[model samples]
Target chain A: MKTDVSSRVVDKGQKQSHFTANLGSRYTIDRIFKYAAWGATGVSILILVWLLVTIVADGIGTLNWNFITSFPSRRAENAGIIAALVGTVWVMCLVALFTVPLGVGAGIFLEEFAEDNWFTRLVEINIGNLAGVPSIIYGLLGLAVFARIMQPITGGRSVLSGSLTLSLLILPVVIVSTREALRAIPNSLRLAGYALGATRWQVIWSHVLPAAVPGILTGVILALSRAIGETAPLIAVGAAVFISFLPEGLQSQFTAMPIQIYNWVGRPQEEFHYIAASGIIVLMAMLLVMNGVAVYLRNHFQKDF
Target chain B: MTDNVTGDIAPGSWSPKRDRAKAIQTIVKIIFGSFAAISILTTIGILATLIFETIEFFKEVPISQFLTDTRWTPLFASKQFGIFVLVSATMMISVISIMVALPLGLLSAICLSEYATPRIRRILKPMLEILAGVPTVVYGYFALLTVTPFLQIFLPDLQGFNALSAGLVLGIMITPMVASLSEDALYAVPRSLKDGAYALGATKRETVTSVVLPAALSGIVSSLILATSRAVGETMIVTLAAGANPTLGFNPFVPVMTMTAFIVQITKGDAPYGTIEYKTLYAVGMTLFIMTFALNIFSFWFVRRFREKYD
Candidate 1:
């Protein structure tokens, strides 16, 4: 009986050896294709490099102070981005003002007060769906609602109308991110706050907001950057591409960096194309700066938590 | 836990501090509730605007003609409002973009998940995010001014403004999105399954193919669906490179206007606020909105259906 058992164990060991199965073309193909995956990443990097190179080559000369300070002109050399720059800043500020409070408050409610029931689940799902809605569609809503329906209030395609549209566009993203930020806090913090005499609002105000600030700030910056680059929706809502003056208030007509770049790219003149390249460089720089702030805040908070 | 609080909360009397706290709590609750309703209100507003305008547009132009006709010349002296012309163009670009995004995206994701070292992953992930963050308008500019010109050199017959360049660049924009989502899916596959494959003397490739890929199949599929939705709704790239011609054809070499481009075209000109021409935008928006809305729902549902829990 011992001899028979030993023979059976030896047979099992032989059957389970690492090289029991012969290597074949399938394995070879997969091994070879691993490099193809790396190659795919390389190709993406190449295209990015090429895009940056092409625009930088064309646009470098147009990045001087005069380019930023001068007003729009029939002459490409004389036209500056003062109006577009001002309009972009105005719109971003208004978007920040409108989106932050509502987004953060909604996030707090969803994380703390929501019952985790079907109604709250539906709301969560609805927010996700809204984030995917095309910006151009938002433009249509803005056109109908802000530009026309609320004409008396928005003053018809002024910065107010444009800002409100952008606010609505970014609100979903803000809410989602803020929820993520708020959710990162430990439940013990809430329980401890309640262990004292603190009300729910007081606990959240004192304990949660400080902890979530960095994450919320990161999300807000990214959302604002997205709003900054948006052009199609603004186009839909009647942003003039060639505005040469600043928006004095919320109701004034405005032009943004993207709209300006878009118009310059479309002009028949070669110089305008070069100018468009410069505008692109500026836009890209602003994007990088915003992203930088977000990264810094994220790192600082991550180190804390 | 509640007994002390209940005993402290006497029926008919309150201190000034408690009264203030109660009032503040009531106000805060109302504020938060209203803030939460903003999202719902946004959805309602979008639907109402689109539907109201679309209903008015259909009263003038029949739905059957809008869907079935072959031409879409809304602003011409003689009008033929065929929605298929735009739908086909949108489909053609969407299909081309998917073809470009899928292989590149999936391969990169597989490579990152299955092969790359942690250091490599950290480096590659940020590069991908940077790629993703480059704005669509910038991509549009590159597609029009750079990619189109480069493609014309090889395919000499390619139009100055054609679907191929726009589709290709849009694919580039979408690849990182696909890679990130798919990588998360692949990462979620349990390690024990992979170890089991190894224990059974399977090669790494064999293990991934038969074990991991199948395990992550629904996630991969949902990523594809989400990518498709993104391509369908993309605007600036197509607007800049795909030309404004609303031609009815499948040729990626020729200039064709997508539904998004049509909306941009009409809105840029702002035909006349209440004209049928103006209301045509809402009809187009309705179609675009419906397409994206349905795709997003399907994506979420597909993901939930295949959700896996591992010990």
Candidate 2:
């Protein structure tokens, strides 16, 4: 009986040591993991900070009123982004004009009017697929359809073609966001309108649209910001790199800020790289303003249930 | 009864204003319906454009030669149309990017979902999104002018336009996307499961690795696939930094041209419409489109098939 008791005591001691060892190692592993994750997060933030600081430091000296106003030149020092800037504005305006109506209408139809069916499902799937398609592929589509086939109407790789391509590119984003915004409104509002003998269209126009406007506007602004930064599609649509004059109309050939920046970056000169950095600053500033407005709209006007 | 009380309309008679409003509603529905159909039209346009041009391209270059040949020198006098050269380069860069992005993105996602407080998440999420919102052209500039130069200091043999720099920057560009999607997935893991793990005397890391990660596997895989698709379709960074040389091997140090980069090169140059050279762009694009489309479809399918249901 004495020998059996001693053996049991020895077994208990071994179990205790093993448990403590496992606990210590587990804690150590957890600590190591925590530090590793923090390190990853730090690396991402560092990269962003480094990128912005580099661009800003390199370009701040060259940024001036003339840099924004003058035309492209053969001399790197004299060259400016006036043509590209104006072209971007022109394209963005047209893109907005085309995208908002079509995208919102589609969203309203799918969310409000259309019944659950295979066709609606197909469209949803198609839009999802299109969103994942590369921007360069859209550029190819624009080249074939808007630029080549519809040349008589689009004037062949003009601002109109670029705008149309970007409109298509961002159309999915707008439609998806609009649907989400519309979906967020309580169904009780629609039912109340109907109970008051309101037509569907009347209910949508008088009650639903006003409530969803802030949300839809925010989405549109974000989508436009994305469209503004697109370079591959613009390049594929044949945006000029060295247009000296500003775009006169939708039909006029043009260059955009990104395409211009791309042109400058591609050149084998140090001065052009600095100028490209300046152009990027302007583009990023525009995006920042747009995104700021979007945030404000979301936070300031968002309503709770 | 209401009509009789108002004395404005007969019970059985059609009111002109009501008829007009009804007609307007029908017309409005048609307009909206047609607007929705535009997306369908876009898909059709892409398919039709690619198919027509691709068919034309195949007529000039045999399918076997296009697939089997090792050289892609259609622009030169000795015309060889092997697509493997470009595809190999594209795959090499994509693999390099995936290597950099997957681990970094997943770990950051874990930290955000499991460790960060709500306020910290709010701040960090937007900061990461800002990284995503930076334009691709800017990234290309950074890659060519800054990243390559910096990388050369460590590896002296790195070319001015090497795949390593382009892939590395592309990885950075896509990290936010992977993190955001994966965080959503990890956050969706049922709290009850995590609580059970804690009750069972499991550490946070053990619970996450054994239970949470397993449940969120489908979503994580889909996000990875989507990121891969993005890398495959990336154009500007590859074009600007990865040089125009279409090589057949997997060397990150040398200059390589991706499929998208080739399209950009052709588009930027004077490959006039209807020429064999111009047709080759569509051919390469068709290949690229098929690859991305397959990946996207697979991602969707995987999510639908394997997602863990908590309810």
- State which candidate has the highest TM-score: 2
Which tens-of-lDDT digit does each residue in B86-175 have in candidate 1? 989999999999998898899889889988889898988888888899888889989999999999889999998999999999999999
Off by over 4 Å in 2: A1-21, B1-17
Tens-digit lDDT track of model 2 for A36-143: 887898899999999999999989989999899989887878989999999999999999999999999999999998988987888898999999999999999999
lDDT per residue for candidate 2 within B1-311, as digits (tens), equals: 44554466446564335556667878888999899999999999999999999999999999999999999998899999999999998898888888888988999999899888888888889999999999999999999999999999999999999999999999999999999999999999989999999999787889999999999999999999999999999999999999999889999999999999999998987678999988999999999999999999999999999999998
Q: Kindly list the per-residue Cα lDDT of model 1 for residues A1-305, writing each as its tens digit.
A: 11222122222245555643334454566566767888887887788889999999989998889998987778999888889999999999999999999999888888887778876777787898898899999999999999998999889988999999999999988998999998888888889988887888888999988888999999999999999999989999989887777899888999899988888887779898888899999999999999999999998775344
Give the winner by DockQ. Answer: 2
The CAPRI-style docking tier of model 1 reads medium
Identify the runs in model 1 with alpha carbons over 4 angstroms from their true place.
Answer: A1-20, A24-27, A303-305, B1-16
The CA lDDT at B7 in model 1 is 62
Lowest-lDDT window of 10 residues in candidate 1 chain B? B12-21
Number of residue pairs clashing in candidate 2, backbone atoms closer than 3 angstroms, sequence gap of 3 or more or interchain: 0
Range of the 10 consecutive residues with the lowest summed lDDT in candidate 2 chain A: A1-10
